[model samples]
Target chain A: MTITITAFSKSPDQGMGLARDTRVRWALEEAGLPYEVRLVSFRAMKQRAHLGMQPFGQIPTYQEGDLVLFETGAIILHIAEHHAGLLPNDAHARARAITWMFAAVNTVEPPILELVTARIFEGDKPWSKERLPLVHDRIRNRLRQLSTRLGDADWLDGSFSAGDLMMVHVLLRLRLSGLLDEFPNLAAYVARGEARPAYQRAFADQWAINKPAAKAR
Target chain B: MTITITAFSKSPDQGMGLARDTRVRWALEEAGLPYEVRLVSFRAMKQRAHLGMQPFGQIPTYQEGDLVLFETGAIILHIAEHHAGLLPNDAHARARAITWMFAAVNTVEPPILELVTARIFEGDKPWSKERLPLVHDRIRNRLRQLSTRLGDADWLDGSFSAGDLMMVHVLLRLRLSGLLDEFPNLAAYVARGEARPAYQRAFADQWAINKPAAKAR
Candidate 1:
């Protein structure tokens, strides 16, 4: 069965590999799966076909055989469940890993996203500049806890798993805000994730598509 | 092993059951499982003991035997995976259902939590009134897509699985904002979820803990 996923035809990240398709691609690489990407322009992403695949009109929708899955967490989990490399064999360890996955998106990402909205979407608003510090603080609170938990640890739990993959990506967004630097351990943690062979391959794949176009423009 | 979970000693919602614990409680109920609840004060939630179980220092950690799990999405997923009722029997369907769970928390709840932040945490800010419309519009964008996907359907996917349970609870938070009312179909969908015996039991339990305290205060 051919595995196909959708990504931005031209990513707004401009080859930074922050776009979520990199997450799915990273998971596939970690799982040692060969998959195809179907690029969708921003306009086409709003069209009926793309909306049918991803109701949220976002990239990184996955398909294999008859199964179509959206949501990066779910896609990563699906791959992790089917493949041996991304999850632990121990039942309790696997459950804890999944807990970290949820913590990454739900608890950690929300504040980081607010920072994005503050800086990008509403950066021009009258409040954007004023609100930036508050947004940063909110992110800092989460990072403080995360940094405490992750101190001296290679991963959130034992060994690198999908949990680390998700958290590292979520924290990578903080590079622009420079918040991840406040916690040196977390910065090192994300650096470790980026250094992973799988993540390097995924980053390269997204870069291939995004970089040339960025230069052309 | 006895199943134990934590909740707010006194929930911020005044017992409307908007807390994440209710989501887990609802999942447990749907699975026909009996569980014990331990109440954690907001101060204690930040303390070392609670933080040990939940790194983010938020409630609704699950403990069974030696395994401790936090994050409502992961806890509900843990229950749904171990139990028979909360998930579909078919593999593809189960994956799709889990996608909705991720969609609920990752995609849907982020915008809603922003609304909460705008109205509650930053309500006194100079820009709160001016900024609220943008936040509301962001939410409307998500709900519009969700409404389109959920058109004339009883659930996000087939049956009343954990996905619906999650989406329903996520949407339930919007009731305080009254945004759910704007989309009649979604409102009805949430009503259907609330009408479930399990959700009712979950709600009543939280209400019992919260309502009398509100009156006394």
Candidate 2:
């Protein structure tokens, strides 16, 4: 079965590969699976067709034959579960890896997401300047804990798994904020993730679509 | 293997069962698994021992034999994968169910968490009153999409899988805000989740620990 995943017709990030689709694409690349991309405009994402596939009407819905899955974590996990590279063979190790995956999204990413909300959506608000520091502080708190746990480790757990993939992507959002630089280990960690052959391929694939040259074409 | 989990020594919700441990307990109950709970105080949670088990220093870490797991979604998923009731048998349905679990935490809960942050942490800010409507509007946007998808369905997908278990728990947070009532189907969906015997048992168990009378004892 050919796997088909969705991406933004034109990513708001403009080829930075920060979009959620990059996560799914990276997972597929790691799994060595061939997949196709279906681009959806911001408008179509809210329409009945796309909403049927993704309840939240978000980009990056995964489809293979009769199976349709949304949410980047789920898509990545599904790919990881079916393939060998993305998860460990040991049951306990695999469970721990999955735990890291959840921790990345639920515990760690929420604060980082709040920083995005503070900067983008509420940037012009009267309190944005004052509230921005608080959001950054909260993000730093999480990063501090994460950095402590990660201290000099190559990946989150033993080897690179979907957990690391998800964590690196979540941390990528903080790059522009300069918070990621505060923790040298985490910054190096993100660099390592980006250094992966799979990640590079995935990044280039999305970059083709959102690149200014492609837009001009 | 004896399954042991951790909970707040005294939940901030005061027995309302909004804590993450409640979700883990609910999953265990639905799976018909008997487990033990170890309560940890806020100060103790920040100490080395608890922080070792949970890197983020949050409650609801699961331990069985040599395996230790934190993050309620991961714990519930671990239980559901090992046990019977919380997931479906079909592969595709199971993937979709897990998708909802991620959706609950990643997509749906983030805004709800923002609401909590606005109300509890930022309530004293000069911009609290003015900024709240923006936060509430963001939540309403998600609820609108969710309510539209739910329509007349009893669950997000079918047969009351882990997806419903998670989505219901995420929506439960909105009850105090009165936003849930705006979407009648969503309100009824939460009611159905509450009516479950497993959920009821989980609720009562936590209530026993955090109830005022029990706290006095």
Candidate 3:
């Protein structure tokens, strides 16, 4: 069956591969699967057709024949479930890996999203600058716990499963804030994920589509 | 195997049944599974022992024999995967149900979490009152999308899968904010979830534990 995934027609982060689609692409790459990218314009994303497929009007929606899925966590988990590269064979280990996926989105990413809101949406507000430290503190608390859990381990659990893919992607968002540097192991862990061949290909592919736009600006 | 899950020794909402454990209990009740609770003190939550099972030191962690799990989404998904009542048997439908589970947390809950942070952590700040509308609007956007999707349907997709369980629990957080009332259909949908026999049991079970503490306060 042919696989097609939606992505931003116009890159939000220039060509940095910070968009959610890049992680989905990385997962597909890790699974050694070839898929087509369906670029969706921001306007089109909110239109009826897209919303029918993804109620959230977000990018990185997966469509394999008649089956459709959204939510990067779910999409990644789907890929991992079908592919050998992303999850453990053992039942308990697989469950633990899935736990990390939930933790990455629900536990860790919320604070980072708050940080984003503080910087972008509330940036012009008088309290934005002053209140940012509070948001940072919250993000730091999660990073501290995650770093402590990770330690010097190569991955969160073992063998770089989807859990690591998700946690690494979640932590990657913090690089712009520079809080990741505070935790050396976490930073290194992110670096290791970036160094993966699949991630490299995913980055390069998105970069190819976004480079001209970045240069033009 | 006797399933044991962790909960807060002291109820944060004073027996309002807002604790994460209530949702876990709801899942267990729906699955017709009896489980024991291991209450963890706030101070103990941070200690290495508790942190070992739950890296982020959060509540409603699941332990069944040697299998230990954290992240309520993960725990609930695990229960659903193993039990008959929580998930659809068809593969694609099952994936769709899981999609709602992720959407409930990753999409809908993030803004609610921000609202919590704004109210609790930043409430004393001068901007708190003024800034709440922005947070509320973010939540409203999500609710609008979700309400549109839910329409007149009693559940998100069909037949009260784990997706509905999670979405119901997530939306339940907004009842105090009164935003849920704004979307009449969504409010009714949440009420339907609470009206479930299993949900009633879960709420009662958590209430049983927290009632004494509430009276003491």
Candidate 4:
């Protein structure tokens, strides 16, 4: 069955590959799956059609035959479960990897998201400047723990799995904030994830779509 | 294998069951699995021993034999995968159910968490009163989308699965905020979740541990 995933028609990231479709695309590449993309405009995403597929009406909904899945973590896990490379064969190892996937999103990403809201949505607010450090410190606390756990390790656990994929992408959002640089090991880890052939392919695919030149085409 | 999980020695919620451990306990109850709980103090949670089991230094870590896992989503998923009640047999339905789990934590809970931070952590800040409405609106936006999707349905998807388990727990956090009351359907949905036998057992279990009388005893 051909897999179809939705992405922002013109991503807010403007080809930076920070949009979540990059995460799903990267998972598909890692799993060696061929998938098609259906772009949805910001307006259409809130409409009935897109809302039916994604309850949150967010970009990056997955469809394959009769199966439809949203949530990047779920999409990646579904792809990983069906494919060989993205998850470990050992049941315990696989469970541990999945734990990391949850940790990445639930524990780590929430603080990073607050930083985004601070900078982007509430930038002009009276508290924005004073509150910025508090948000950054919250992120740093998480990164400090993560960096300590990741010391000298190549990936989160043994080999690169969906956990690493999710963690690396979550850490990517911290790049512009310079918080990632404070943790050298995490920065290196993100670089290693970026160095992956699958990630490279995924990045290029979204870049092609969102690039200024491609818009003219 | 006997399953052992951890929770806060004295929860901040006092007996209300808003903690993530309640979610895991609810899943175990739904699965008809008996488990043991080990309570850890706030200081202990940040110590090396606890951090070894949970890198993020949070509670609700599951240990079954050599397979140890943290993150409530992953733990509940592990239990649901092993048991019958928490998930559907259909592969597609199962994937969609897991999608709701991720949606609960990633999409919906983040804003609610921000509300918690705003009220508890930053309540003394000068901008708390002014910025709260913005945070509340963000949550309302997500709930509005969720309420629209739910309509008259009892659950997010068909049958009560881990998705509903998670979404209900996530929404439970909103009760004190009064934001949940705005969405009558969602409030009823959460009440429906609380009314379940499994959920009732889970709540009573935590209440036994954290209740003021029990603490005095």
Candidate 5:
């Protein structure tokens, strides 16, 4: 059975690959798995059937044969587990790689999300200006700690795995904030991830989808 | 080798079971794993050695023999993978369960964390009050989607697994915001999770460490 996934019809990011589907797409491309994309409008997303695939009614749901999965982290993980390249063969290294995947989403992404909230959704608020600095500081604080640990290392653990894939996606959100540039090492680290062929393929694929619409606008 | 975990010396939650360590403790209790808790002061967490164990320098890093892992999602996953009960025996089902776990952390928790950032960190911001409603709406929107899908379903999947444990914990953060009350089903759902004997045991065990100080306050 063909694997099918859903993504935003017109991503708010203008196909910069910030969408969660980009991660899933990147994983699929890395695994050399040919899949189909099902673009969904924001309206259709809240529908009953769509909500069944995603309880939170978010995009990038994976469906293969009888199995259906939601969440980019989960979808990428499933691909990584079934495919060879996304994880390590060594037992300990595999466990550590999985740990970094969780860190990327759980620990690092939270503050970045706050920055987004401050910028887009809360931009009109009176305290948006004052609160923006605090959100930035929180992100910087996390980045400083992470930079210190990642010092002089290419990846969070030995060899890149799904962990780095997720981490790069998380850090890419900070690109607009300029917080990533503060740590030269971290900035270079993210650059390395973006430069990956898999990431490039994913970026181009999504960008192709939105390019026409952006031009029309 | 025994596993060493880190936790707050005195939880600021004051035994309310809001601490991240409680999640690790709950998972450990459920796994029937014997572990040691190393109380960490906020100052010590920023140190080099401790940061080595946890890149983000947060509590609840798992150290068993030579293996070290951080991120509650990763630690819980490591525990669930090593043990039996936290995952399903069926390969596909297990993968889906893992996906829900990621969704809990990556999707659901982001908005709740936004509420926290707004009220606690950005409370002093001039636009804090105006931004609060937007944050609440974002959370409510996610909750509504979740509630609609969860309609009468006891769990996100077949049986209670680490996914539910993570999801329940993520939803628990909304209790203080009163947003949970907007969705009666989700509020009840969280209660169901809290009612679990394993969850109770985990709560009590961690609460014991902070009970005296809670009394003092």
Candidate 6:
């Protein structure tokens, strides 16, 4: 059965692929799977129907026939589990690939989110100027450790899997911060993921919708 | 094969069982699996060996034979995948259970962590009072959505799975704020999870180690 997922009617990111559905879309595109998107306003997201699908009323919930899934990690993992090209065939390698997936979301993304919060939500706070450098340093610490581990390797692990997909997405959030430039190898790693034809298609698709909205305003 | 997991050499929470390792311990107890804990200091968590195991320099990493896994969601999911009782037998039900696991971490925990940051890290700030409500409201909004979906339902889905384990743990963070008291149903839901003997045993085990440290100080 074909799948359907949800996204912001008007994404806050303005088509930067930071909306997370971009990752799902990119993954599906990479897997050569066609899918549908249902736009959810902030209001509709909290409604009974949406809450039935997503406990926390967040975006990019996946549905296939009677099966409904939420949480970007879970949704992406579900897709990778049922589809090909997203995971390796070997058992040990596959486990390692899944490890990377967890690392991306659970490990890498937290500091990035902290950076976002400091910049966006706490921007006006007096301490933001002082606090941001600490957050940036934390991010750099993670990047340095990751860069060290990933030294001279193309992907975090062997041949790209869902883990690389997630790590790339997590790292992409650093683009505007310019901190990514500090780690050229990590920057190139993100570039490699973005350069994937599937990623390009997904980016173009979402960007197509986003650019016009920006223009109208 | 026996499994080895990490815990705080002395938890900052004293005996409160708020530490991440307690979650893994609870999962292990619930699964009726035997395991050992390797208490690590903050310094050890950042050391090369620990960093090799956990990229984020956090706790509750799982090690079995040659397999090592980090991220509580990933670890719990792995345990649930290998052991029965943590997942439903039906395919669709299983997917939904896993979805809740993601929701607990990605959606619910972020706002709760905000509350932590505000209360602990930025408590001295002039804007702490104003920002605290915003963080609390964000948490309440999540709980409201969750409470509405739960209604009179005992568990999030059919049976108690690792998903519920995660959801309960995430919700438990709000206990001190009394915001959880605002949702009696969710509070009771958390109570039920805590009442589990497995949870009790896990709590005591961690507490046994943590309590003395608090007293010594």
Give each model's whole-structure lDDT. 0.93, 0.93, 0.93, 0.94, 0.86, 0.85
Superior candidate under lDDT, 5 versus 6: 5
Residue A76's lDDT within candidate 6 is: 82
Single out the weakest 10-residue window by summed lDDT for candidate 4 chain B. B208-217
Candidate 2 backbone overlaps, count: 0
Pick the winner on TM-score between candidates 4 and 6. Answer: 4
- Residue B64, candidate 6: C-alpha displacement in angstroms: 1.1
Q: Which one is best on DockQ?
A: 1
Question: How displaced is residue B189 in candidate 6, in Å?
Answer: 0.8
What is the Cα-based lDDT of residue A147 in candidate 1?
Answer: 94
Which CAPRI category fits model 3? Answer: high
Task: Tell me the tens digit of each residue's lDDT in model 4 across A27-118.
Answer: 99999999999999999998989999997889999999988899999999999999988999999999999999999999999999999888
Which ranges of candidate 2 are over 4 A from the true structure? A214-217, B214-217
Clash list (residue pairs), candidate 4? none
Can you write out model 3's per-residue Cα lDDT over A1-217, one digit (the tens) per residue? Answer: 9999999998878888888999899999999999999999999999999999999888989999999999999999888888889999999999999999999999999999998888889999988888989999999999999999999999998888999998898888888889999999999999999999999999999999877543454
DockQ for the candidate 6 complex? Answer: 0.53
What is residue B52's positional error in candidate 4, in angstroms? 0.4
lDDT of 2 by residue, A1-217 (tens): 9999999999999999999999999999999999999999999998989999997888999999989999999999999988989999999999999999999999899988898788789999989988988888888999999999998999988999999999999999999889999999999999999999999999999999998763443
- Candidate 4 local Cα displacement, residue A2, angstroms: 0.6
Candidate numbers, best lDDT first, in rank order: 4, 1, 2, 3, 5, 6
Stretches of candidate 5 exceeding 4 Å from the true structure: A212-217, B214-217
Show the lowest summed lDDT stretch of 10 residues, model 3 chain B: B208-217
Clashing pairs in 5: A126-B127, A127-B126, A127-B127
Better of 1 and 3 by lDDT: 1
Candidate 4 per-residue lDDT over residues B168-198, each given as its tens digit = 9999999988999999999999999999999
TM-score of 4: 0.98
